[model samples]
Target chain A: MIALEVKKMKKNFGGVKAVDGLSLKFEKGQITSLIGPNGAGKSTMVNLMTAMYPPDAGKMIVHGVTLEKWKSYNMPTYGVTRTFQDVRLFEQMSVLDNVLVVLTERGVFRSLFETHGELHLKQAEEILKRVDLWKKRDEKAEDLSYGQRKLLEIGRAVAMDADIYFFDEPFAGLFKEMVKTVVSILHELKNNGKTILLIEHNMDLIRELSDHVIVVDAGKFFAEGEASDVLARKDVVEAYLGE
Target chain B: MDYIMHLSVLVGVYAILGLSLNLVVGYSGLLSLAHAAFYGVGAYGSAILMKDFGFSFLSAVVLSVLITMAVGVLIGLVLSKFDGDYYALASLGFSVIAFGVFLNWRDLTNGAFGIFGIPKPEIFGYKFLAGEPYAFLVLLAVIFTFLICYFVVNSSFGRVLKAIREDEKALQVFGYKTTLYKLAVFVISAGLAGFAGTLYGSYISFIDPGGFDDLVSVNLIVVVILGGLASLNGSLLGAAFFVLLPELLRFVGMPDSITGQMRQMIYGLGLIALMMYRPQGILGKFRL
Candidate 1:
């Protein structure tokens, strides 16, 4: 079943067409890799889908419901959540609190009086352990090393427990072992029947992890197929090589 | 001893102001300079309701807070469109406008003549006269305000506020209505400031536009920054320092001719030195 569909989306910045007439579909319970060369509107596409920026013209259908006048803050209610291309953790907060923030009550009045109960703690602990940061949960996010911060960001995403997850350059600066941890997390999300839209530049990891791949260049679709098939295309090579 | 009690009352009033303002400036990272306007609204609102409308002290305070919160909502909606320096500038403008109203609104506020002979608070047939009784009333108010701030800072709402301070955009993608949270804190902070204004006006028995000017809002900011940005106890400590420091300088016995001017210089120097060495303040976790 199609989990998310973007039809003829258009976005412009001044005279530049950041995301001009783009279209794509992401299926449920599958890992789809969105690959592109530099300045390919990959991040812009994620932003549009997540409602960070309103599209100039397009329709987004999630779970067969057309999104009309949606906002970034309400996207999670639609079971959509995303991580930033540049890791954006609450820096001064503790690692545990970072994950717990996602589990907080949404209502302003209820949240004002409600303390994080045992259920919240248990869920946070489970996510922290999954990211292998349980031991460092008490440490401030700013105090964590580069790799640990990435994992904590992932742990926060896990706490969201959304139907669709957008991971933008999740493996950008991780060590080999940390990459394994994130790869496992993607698999776990897929196993739980969550739609995964991944933006990554690492060809090997994309080939190994993606059930399907879609390529875009200069805000337009270039090619897409099973990962192995599209990555080997002549046009895809030239686009990446800038030939 | 009476002088000490008077200072103590002043401390209590400023403490409430500091705690409330910290929720916006410290926790939510909104640099609001219109706090004194809300403070004046509370003072003037209660004063008018009690003196002109013949309302009781308790009802006056309650109604004044509601009125101030409504005003806060209107101001907060406008301020919500701005962030960072623009937010601070807009809030400063509001304080100036509020001061203009207090200064020129002749029929209601009596213009520059000010309000005098305001009635003492009467609870359960017991009138709270000046000195110890008023001091005790303010102390109770301080305790109540402290508990409210403490509970708010510890709850999930406060957690979100701290996150909003760190990165509002990022928090929004986490499914938080950041604008609403910002508005909530701003209104609550304004309401609490108004609550303190009621206590201050009732205690003094007189209030003027000068008491709630932009400079007063700046002083409240200094109190919050000096106490520590995100700490409840820090607000209390900051309020104490602010209220007591200049009074203590009197004992230094600078020639009476230069006493007032000298005290101002020393206080200014002290603050500069403190900020130079400890930008985070005495107990602050975050630096402004």
Candidate 2:
């Protein structure tokens, strides 16, 4: 089943069309890599999809239901979660608290009295261990190394347990071991029937991991298909070199 | 003994103010300058209900808090549109407007003459007279406010507040209605400030528009900063220090004319030193 579908999505910032007439679909339990050169509106597409910026015109259908007047905060309720291109972790909070915060009850009154119980602790521990940050769980997020910070951000997304995970440049500025760790996480998420929309620049990693590929350049669709076919296209190669 | 009790009562009142404002400025990372407005509303609201309408103390306090909370919701809705320095500026503007109303509303507030003859709190036929009885009463209020702040900061809701403080946009992506959280904390903080105002009015037996001005709000911010941002104990310590310091300066024996100026100088210099050395405050874990 198609987990998420965007049709005729358009967004503009003054004279610049950040994301214009973009349409894409991702199926459940599949990994779709969204690739483009710099200034290709890749990040803007993710932002629009996650409702961080309202599209000037479009329709977003998730789980066969059309979302009307959806907001950024409502994305999680619709089983949508995302990581930023620049890792945005709760810097003053501990690694464990970062994950635990995502597991918190959203109801204001109920959460006012709610403490993190054993189940929350267990879930947090599981996520931290998976990210290999269990030992640094007590350390403040700001104190973590860049790669570790990236892991914590992903761990936070895992704690959300949402269906569609938008990993925007999740592999940026990471060591080889950390990259492998993230690769395994993406695979694990896919195995569990989660839809992953990954925005990445690494051609080899995209070729190795993507079940499907979609390319955009200057806020418009350039090419898309199997990763092997799309990456080899003359126009697609020129788009990257042209930039 | 009476003097000590009076000082203790002042400390207790300010402590409650500090704790309430801490929720907004410390945990939620919204620097609010309109706290004293709600504080004034509470004092004026409760004082009027009891003195004019002959309502009981408890009922007056309850109704006053509700009224202040309603005002808070209205103010919070407007404040939520701005962030950082703009939020602070807007809050200061609201506080100025509130003071203007207190000074200009002659019929309801008695104008610059202020409200007098605010009766001491009476519970179960026992009047909490000034001095020891009222001190004890205020002590109870301090403890109550402290526990409320403690429970709130320790809860999952508090965690989200800290997250909101760190990065509101990121928290929104996590499915938290951040504006709602911000509004909730703002209203709660306003209600608590109003509660403190009620306590102050009853203890002092008189309140003027002079008591709830923008300067008073700045002093409350000092109380929070000195005590420590995001630290409950810091609020108490900050309030105690704030209330006691001027009294201590009395023994310095400078000329009476310069004495007030001297106290102001000392307060300013001490805060500057604190910021330079320990910006987080005495017990604060977070620095703005």
Candidate 3:
């Protein structure tokens, strides 16, 4: 079953076509990877799907709902969450606070004086432990090591418990153990029947974790399919592996 | 002795003012220039309720806080659509409009003549008259407001505000509605400013339009950023600087005319220095 459907999508920055009439489908509970040469519309598609930038002309269907039906909520409201290529956390805030912020209920009708209940603290603790950041919970996010900051942001999104997860180059700067930890998390989330979008350059990690693959050049979908089948294509092979 | 009493009350009032503004600019990362308007609203709101409606002092302050919060909600609705420089300008416009209303609406606000003869608050048979007792009253209110803001900004909600400040887009992708959080923090910050306004009106025994110029707004920011942007204790330090500057001027035999302008210049110079050297202010913990 298709979890995400993109059709006739186009995105242009001034005169540059970052995503040119791209179309693709993501299957339910599948780990999809987007791989291509530099300047591919891979991240643009992810941003569009996440509703960061309004689509120039396209239709995106998520969970059997068309673009019209999905118009009610932006990226955040659609139960979609992501991590940036550059790790961004509330630097002055503690590592625990970074994840804890996600657990907050964004309800404004509630009085300003109302406090966060015990459940929020519990969830924050669980996510921090998952990222092995519980020990450094009190430390400022800025004070964390490079890899730890990445893990902290990942922890925040994972703790967010969104329906669709987008990891934009999650493995770019990770150490081996940290990479292993994230790889295991991807499998765990996939095992639990979640949709995952992996935007990465590490072919090994992509092959290991992605159930499906997508290739974009410029702003258009070049190809997409089962992870093995797509990666086997000559064009994808040439563009990525340069064989 | 009389000057010291008045000074103490002003310090306490500015302390509350600084703390209220802190909730917006410090925690929520909003550059709100309309805090003094809400501060004015609070002062005038409580004054009207007590003098016209014949409500008790406590009830009047309570009503004023609620009314200011309602106004905050309205501003939040407009402000929720804006961010960065536009947000600051919009808030400043609000302050300007409110001051205009206070000046023109003579029947309600007595125009520039303003509301006078506001009686001291007497709660539960304890009178908060002028001098030491009143200073004590204002101090307690300032302390209470400080503690409340401190506690909230340290809580989970406060953390989310920081998140919104740091990375609104990242938070949005994380399924957190950044707009709602922004509005929530705005209303909270404005409400606290209104609370300070109530104290200001009672402490001064009067309310007027000129008292709420943009300079007052600038003064509030002066304290918050000078003391430290996000430190809970920074508000107090800011309040001290604002309240003590004039008295310190008296010691140096500076004339009143030059003292006021000199103080303003000092504030400007201090802000520039802080932004250049220590953007985080004194505490240097939460850099905006």
**Interface RMSD per candidate:** 0.8, 0.8, 3.3
Expressed as tens digits, the lDDT of each residue in A1-243 for candidate 3 is 888788888889999998898888878788988888878888887777777788888888877778742331365565677887778788888887787776766664432344665777888888888889999999999999899998988888788687778888888888999998898888888998888888998877887888888888777667778777887888779776675
Off by over 4 Å in 3: A69-79, A109-119
TM-score of chain A of each: 0.96, 0.97, 0.92
* Candidate 1, A87-186: lDDT as tens digits: 8999988898899899989889989977556789999999999999999988989999998998999889989999999999999999999999999999
Q: Write the per-residue lDDT of candidate 1 for residues B129-202, one digit (tens) a residue.
A: 88999999999999999998888888899999999988888899888988888899999999999999999889
lDDT of each residue in B16-131, candidate 2, tens digit only = 99999999998988999999999999999999999999999999999999999999999999998877999999999999999999999999999899999999999999999989
Per-residue lDDT value at A129 in model 1 = 95
Clashing pairs in 2: none
Given the true complex, what DockQ would model 1 score? 0.81
Instruction: Tell me the TM-score for chain B of model 1.
Output: 0.96
Q: Supply the DockQ value of model 3.
A: 0.49
Q: How much RMSD separates candidate 3 from the native structure?
A: 2.4
**Candidate 2 off by > 4 Å:** A241-243
